[model samples]
Target: MVGIGYRKDFAEEFSENTLNPAFIEVAPENWINVGGYYKKMFDKILEKYPLFVHGLSLSVGSPEGIDVAFVKQVKQFLDETKAVEYSEHLSFSKCENAHLFDLLPIPFTEDAVKNVSKNIRQVQDILERKIAIEIVSYYTPIAPEISEIDFINSIVSEADCNLLLDVNNVYVNGFNHQYNPKEFIPKLDLSKVKYIHMAGHTKVASDLIIDTHGENIIDPVYDLFQFTMELMQRDVPILLERDFNIPELEVLQHEMDRLQIIKTNALKQHKHAIIS
Candidate 1:
């Protein structure tokens, strides 16, 4: 399936122009405290396209614990949307008094893994739905004890949940960390991947890549998408994230068209290779 990750305000615009069904990524805070605003917005989108809940502040990797208040808000949204899947980033964004407002990496020690796993279990239980974690893009200051893939695998295995598998994040991390994306993608547990995220990023310096989902999906990311599609060996739902640089609806459609073409070509190549 194909979907677009969008904010709530654009529901009407999305309904009018989108030919294929799209997914809505509702931030709970935006809808929860606005006196039924979220409900009204959600109803409008559900009328047009499929909706899915993607949270930004769940802080699943935090040491404190799953935020029950946040979990309730997400559950309410899921109930309203009837979304098949709920997703959040694996990185932590909050602590007692600090809000990073960005995906922060966790130290990949056994203790950190255990704490995160426990928190994830609590979140799943509270939401009463299966949750998938996204692999976030980081700009170093990372703990040197563990590799990125190992850290992700450990959390998934311990939490016993699925992975969102952001392809752009993989490319970003690969470039920043000085590793090959090809070598990294195959190492993860493919079975745990539930949803795939694709977006555009910006190149700052010669070595720095930022996960800015504000532009068209570039060629290198498209190549990685092809590699991921081959690795998965199935037709999985890919969602394009465009949080910033909000362009004309036509531009978004163009990206979707490119993705469809890539998907088709990948399948054809796989079929031909098997036959040969």
Candidate 2:
């Protein structure tokens, strides 16, 4: 299954198109803060396609206690949409009553893992649905006390929540942190992965990978996606994220077509392997 993240302007076109993505990821802030006008538009889109909520402002990894009001509103929105799943980044977006507007990394230590797990569990308890956390891309390196994969695995295991594996983030972190992305994938508990996220990143200095989500899906990430599909051996739902430099509908459609081609070829290869 494959889907795309949508903003308000493209809601009608996406709804009208018969593409029928596996699911659409909605930003809670956009859907709620916009006047009732946008909500009406969202309702119409919901009528046409399945919706999933992916929040950017939750700041779940923040040390501050959860934002009760925001969580309540998000829950209401999720209930109204009957979203297939809800997800937020594993990094913090807020600190000291200010929005950093970036996904900041945390040290990979037992304390951080415990704190994150507690937050995740609280979110699940409030929503009455299991939630998934996405591993984010980090520009700066943190000399974590533990490895990134182990930290993520511990948090998910403790929180009893699913994982939303972001392939682009993995690639970016691998290049920036000098680790092998392929090695990290198999280390993660596959049972906890409910969905996968793929997106484009910017190339910096011809070596660094910046997760800008503004370019086309590159080859290395595509290759990793193929490997993941084969290893998972299941039709996991995939979401293509485009957050900057909004392209024309036709352009996005082409990307979707490319994704479909990759998915088909990868599945065929996996099948052949099984037969052999």
Candidate 3:
């Protein structure tokens, strides 16, 4: 299945007969406490489709630690909306009292791993749900002490949490950090992956691929998504993100159609493998 993030710009474009998405995702922060037109719009969508919350401000890896109050509020929002899943980035977006406003790579150290795992456990307790952590696209590691795959696996295993695999991040990191994206995949605990995300990035330089999510889904990112589906050997719902410079609703529908085709073909391959 394929879905797109909820955006107010195209709010009017969504309805039962028009550009129907398998699901709709929104940042809970965007709808936690808004009123009037936006609230009604969201309500309408909720009536028709499955809702998923892709969180933005949890800052799970922040040294400042998890915010108990915010987690409670998010839980309340989830309860109200009856969202199926909630996901936040594994990287930290804050330090001390200052909001960095960008996802920063957590240091690759055993101490960092322990801290992040503890935070995830606390969040799970508060939310009363298993929250998936997204793999973020980052330019550099805080330290060269551990491989990215090891850092991720250690935290998820320790916390006993699910993963929100982002194919675009894998492609961007592979290019920026000089590694085969597929090689990184086998090291990961695929059993933990709950869903997948794919988006577009900007190739500013030959070696620097920045995850912008503002452009069209590039060929490489789609290739990576297809590769991931083959590895999983089953159907998993995928969400397309366009947080910046979002195009028309029709364009997103077109992308969704393409994704559906990929998933259809992948499932057929999987069935053949099982039968043979």
Candidate 4:
């Protein structure tokens, strides 16, 4: 099913079309203990639609170690909201005690994989639910001791966690890092894919692309999305992420319609393959 990120900029707009989305993804950090008007608003909406927690501060790859207290708070929030899944970046956002407020690339190494896997296991034990890790977009690799695909595969396999595949990131990283995005798609462990994120990026240069969700979904990204849908043997929740410059709800509804068409077509193709 197609979904969208819940942002306050278009809250009232979303209220009008409650049935348009299959689900809504929210950043737990934004509403963990929110009270008053916003809390009431969210609670009312929660009664209507399912929420998937896409976390911003888990800092899973932090060498400084995972935050136990924060994880407990997240667990409480998830239990309270009945969110179906909790997903965070495979990258780190903190070092030492300082909160960097940005997802940073983790080193592509065996030691880093071990550290991240341990962190995921701890989080899963605390939350009593399987966690999904988003494959992030980075302009540069921190430590290129291993290929990007292998690093990601090892982490999810060792952690025994699900994947939140971000298609735009694949396109951006492929352009900036000089790799075939299509080739990278099949290398992923499709069995672990639970969620998909599709967004637009900015082309600052002929060779550089930034994963900025401010713009509309571009043609190439749409092509990538179609390719992804055609490959998946199972249905996974796909979400449109627009963090800034959000247009009218109607504009988003159009995109949702497009996604529905793609999903329908993909399912037919998958079925034909099975029959053949």
Candidate 5:
């Protein structure tokens, strides 16, 4: 399935019935205990599309450990909304009980593996449902004891959780770290991936690319997405994440249509290869 991220910036377009996606994703922290107009708009959107929640908290890799109270609230919200899926960044965003509002990269070490696995189990137990964790983009890379790919494989296996594969983040990290994005996709446990994210990035310097979900997705990221689907051998839901530079409703719809075409073509290629 294909979808768009629900943002209030497109509230008018949604009311006019211009945007049509199979599903929509939103950050639950923004909606829980909310009231009035936005809440009403969200309820209307829910009627037409399945709701998928992506969280900003949970801080699965933080030293502060899991926040039981926040997760309990999330469980309540998910049950109330009957959300189809929930996801969070694999990176940590909290330190010393204060929200950093940034997706900071976790150190690739054996100790971190155990820490993250325990945190994820706590969340899953409280929610009583598995949650997907996205491989986030980061500008800095600290002294890592293990490789990024190995670190991810270990966590997902130990935690027994799924993944929200962010194609754009892979492209960005590949560029910044001087690795081949094409070669990198195959190393991951693709079977663990439950959802996908595609977005745009900005080239601030000749060598650095920032994961800015502001511009239209470039051709390379799209290429990687279609390539990833071929490996999966099945359809998985993907969402076009345009969190900034809010474009016109038609523009977002056009992107969704292109994704549908690519998704369809990739699956056909896979089936044709099998039959051949």
Candidate 6:
């Protein structure tokens, strides 16, 4: 299946049914108190498509610790919306109890692992269901006591949470940090991947890439997503994100159609392999 993030700009597209997204993801914060036109559209959307809730401000790695009150509010939103799934980045967005306004990398240390794991557990306890954590992209490395993949494995293992794999992040991080993106995917526990996110990025320099979901999914990122589908050998619902510089609805849906084709072809190949 293929999906797209809910944005006000796409409201017309949603109303027209010109683009059929298998599901729609929205940040609960965006609709919590919204009124008027958007609220009416949101209600229609809920009645039309399966809603996947993605969060922007969980700040799972915050050293300030998990916000119990905020989590309760999130739970309330989820319950009200009847959201099927919830996901947040596996990075911190606050320090010293103030919002940093960006998802910052957590230090690759055992202490950091413990911090995030405990936080994840608390969130799961409140939500009463497993929440997916997306492997976030960061421009720089923090104090490294372990490899990035190892650190991620540690936290998920300890916390017993699902993963929201982002193919674009893997590609950008591998280019920026100088590693093989293909090799990185195999290291992850893909069985725990509840869904996948694919997006476009900015190539600021020949050697650096920024995970900017502001453009179309470039060929290389599309290739990475295809490779990921083949590697996982299972059909995972994929989402296309265009947070800014979003193109026309038809163009975006075309990208989604390409993703659907890749998934179908990859799974068929896997089945052929099994038959052979």
Per-model lDDT: 0.81, 0.83, 0.88, 0.90, 0.90, 0.91
lDDT: worst 10-residue window of model 1: 18-27
Cα lDDT tens digits for candidate 2, 1-276: 678897766766766784557668877877765657667777777776688788888887878757778898999988878888899899888877678878889778889888888888888899898888998998874557888888999998999998999988998889987889999898999888988899999988766778998998888998898888878877778898888877777777777777777878888888999899
Give the alpha carbon lDDT tens digit for every residue of 246-267 in model 4.
Answer: 8777778778778778878888
* Model 4: lDDT of residue 38: 67
Ranking by lDDT: 6, 5, 4, 3, 2, 1
Query: Clashes per prediction?
Result: 0, 0, 0, 0, 0, 0
Candidate 2 TM-score versus the reference: 0.92
Please give the distance, in angstroms, between residue 10's alpha carbon in candidate 6 and its true position after superposition. 2.0
Query: Candidate 1: where are CA atoms >4 Å away?
Result: 8-12, 35-42, 272-276
Which runs in model 6 stand beyond 4 Å of their true positions? none
Q: Between the candidate structures 1 and 5, which one is better when assessed by lDDT?
A: 5
Q: What is candidate 4's CA lDDT for residue 232?
A: 84
Q: TM-scores of all models?
A: 0.92, 0.92, 0.97, 0.97, 0.98, 0.98
Looking at candidate 5, what is the lDDT of residue 86? 94
Tens digits of lDDT, candidate 6, 168-237: 9998999999999999999999999999999999989988888889988889888988889899998888
Q: Write the per-residue lDDT of candidate 1 for residues 104-147, one digit (tens) a residue.
A: 88776777878888888889899887798999898874555776
In model 3, the runs with Cα more than 4 Å from the true position are 15-17
lDDT of 6 at 32: 76
Residue pairs in collision within model 6: none
Q: In model 2, what is the error at residue 53, expressed in angstroms?
A: 0.9
Worst 10 residues of 4 by lDDT: 10-19
lDDT over C-alpha atoms for residue 125 of model 4: 94
Cα lDDT of candidate 4 equals 0.90
Q: Poorest 10 consecutive residues of model 2 by lDDT?
A: 14-23
Model 4, position 144, has a per-residue lDDT of: 77
